[model samples]
Target: MANFFDFGLTLDLLRLPFVQLALVVAVVLGLLAGVLGPLIVSRNMAFSVHGTSELAFTGGAAALLLGWDIGNGALAGAIIAALVLGLLSRRSSEYDSVIGVVLAFGLGVGVLMLYFYKGRASNKFGLLTGQIVGQDFASFALLMACAAGVFAVLAVIYRPLLFASVDPEVARARGVPVTALALVFAVLVGVATALGVRTVGALLVLALMVTPAAAACRVTASPLRATVLSVLFALVSAVGGIILSLAPGAPISAFVTAISFVIYVVCWAVGRARGLTRA
Candidate 1:
């Protein structure tokens, strides 16, 4: 087993260019996920995120097979999945079923693609469980550019988006473009989920994209407060997980998920205690 307590090794690893790039990627993904998490929760799109992530994996696998940029492939696949889901799952009764059908198909296709790829086994593994070395300066720059676009779009539509999420009927009655907003938001979520797949993998993307926001919501009803707390929680989980994994040479997703789950549990306990006190 690798020495988990090797502080000297950890510090040395941290100074490496790849490790530094991973840290930056984690930070970007953390902030993006944090900002999007609350909106996703409020809109009841957690399952959508899961489905999108799988399609992203499929896309990445396809890219690997075709010798294309994996990040771009994943992003394209996620965006397409988001659009399909947004269109087909318009009704509440059909939402979960639509996601289930799409997710299953995507996963199957992804597996087949992986099987056909004669490249490094680690590349296939990375799509499912993240590999920090998969990131480079070029991909990192693309991620940043995408993140900036998402933020800009959100800045313009945040108020109406929040309203539509909270009360779609009222928002529609108020002349808000509810349907359009929902589609746009799904695309934004797809982008973020694709980015997260690089750090936490498609299987565990929710640790960064949903858990922090869910924890924040447990503690507060205010959207602004929830968003702020969610961002902080996600940052801690992502960065801390990366740092902790360095010494052990373990999978980063494991650490990220554990930290996120712990935060959720703590928030749940506090919320329950507050409820009991109020009663």
Candidate 2:
């Protein structure tokens, strides 16, 4: 059995270039998830995020099969899915069903693409789960650029988006362009989800994108405080997960999800205690 607490091995792995790059990727992913997660939860778009990630996986798989850039493909696939969902489910009643239909189709297509690809098993596996070593400098650069773009776009629309998310009817009455904001926000989420799929894997991207924000919301009602706490939680989960996985040589997503869930549990306990004290 491998020693889970091998400090020496952990230190050695940290010293390698790929591992260092992976850490940077995790940081970027954490920040992106943190910034967008609260909005996703507030707007009840968690299912939409999942659907976006699945389409991202499909895009990544298609990229592997076609010998193209996985990140680019994933981004394209995710945006398309977001647009489709947005257009089809303009009514709140149809939202969940639209996501379900798109998710199922995207997953089936992703599976078919993976089946046809006879390349490295790790590449295919990484689409569903995650692998860090495959990220070279070019891919890293692309990830950085995409992250910057998402941040810039969010900066321009954050207030309106938040307003729309919290109360769409009121926001629309105030001429906030709620529908346009929703479409833009969905695309932004798709971009973030695509970035996360590369680090946390499509199957478990929710740990970073939703769980941290959910935990933060449980403890705090203030939007700014929730965003801050969510970022902190996501950073700890992503970076800590990578560090812990180093010695054990385990999948990063497993550790990431585990740490995220633990944080959520702790926050839940604290929130429950507070509620009881108030009562």
Candidate 3:
């Protein structure tokens, strides 16, 4: 426990090959999740993040069973779930019901797959929880490519997409192809969620993806500023948590989630204070 605050140990950890790559993964996932999170909140699809991640879990489990790369399985599962959810929830009235069913089913599938894997237990736990170490160059490069694609899509669709997210009816009236845009955005969110699942685990992926943006939104209504702050908050949480966990032999997910939750709480209080002071 004495080494918990040892900066020297943390710096030494950064010298490891896997640790170097994991840091890069943290930064990229942070930025990707940050960009998509506010839009998810605004569109009221926060629930969908969890649902999609459950499917990502199933995918990772399946990959483990088949000896395939877990990241590929996770990304495929997430994208499939996102597309299905988008199609099924075309009418807002059915969004909750459809996603709820999908979430449960995904969990069951993952459990079944994991049960038959017969591998070291740590690998299974890592999928459900998170592991900050053991990252490889191949996985890191794939993640970077996927992140770039996701960001490019976001840049192209952001304007009309934002409009559609804010008010679908209005966006539809403006001929913005709201349905198409929503489907595209959900797929992008799925991509981010998959990367997040790899970084922080499926259970805690939403913390990186949603909480920072949610906190940022509490303080700012401007989309651009909120996006920037969300990215900033997520980046700090990802990189800072890794640094803190290196010396203490703690879980990266725990530190990351705790940091995100603290940010949200502080921002919420500040927002409340601003409201009172204004009134």
Best by lDDT: 1
lDDT comparing candidate 1 with the true structure: 0.93
> lDDT for each of the candidates?
0.93, 0.91, 0.90
- Ranking the candidates on lDDT from highest down gives 1, 2, 3
For residue 142, model 2's alpha carbon misses the true position, in angstroms, by 1.1
Candidate with the larger lDDT of 1 and 2 = 1
* lDDT (tens digit, per residue) of candidate 3 on 48-68: 999999999999999999999
Q: Write the per-residue lDDT of candidate 2 for residues 76-127, one digit (tens) a residue.
A: 9999998999999999999999999999999999999999999888888877
Per-model root-mean-square deviation over C-alphas: 0.9, 0.9, 1.1
Candidate 1 C-alpha lDDT tens digits along 190-232: 9999988877888999889999999999999999999999999
How good is model 1 by TM-score? 0.98
How far is 143's C-alpha from truth in model 3 (Å)?
A: 0.6
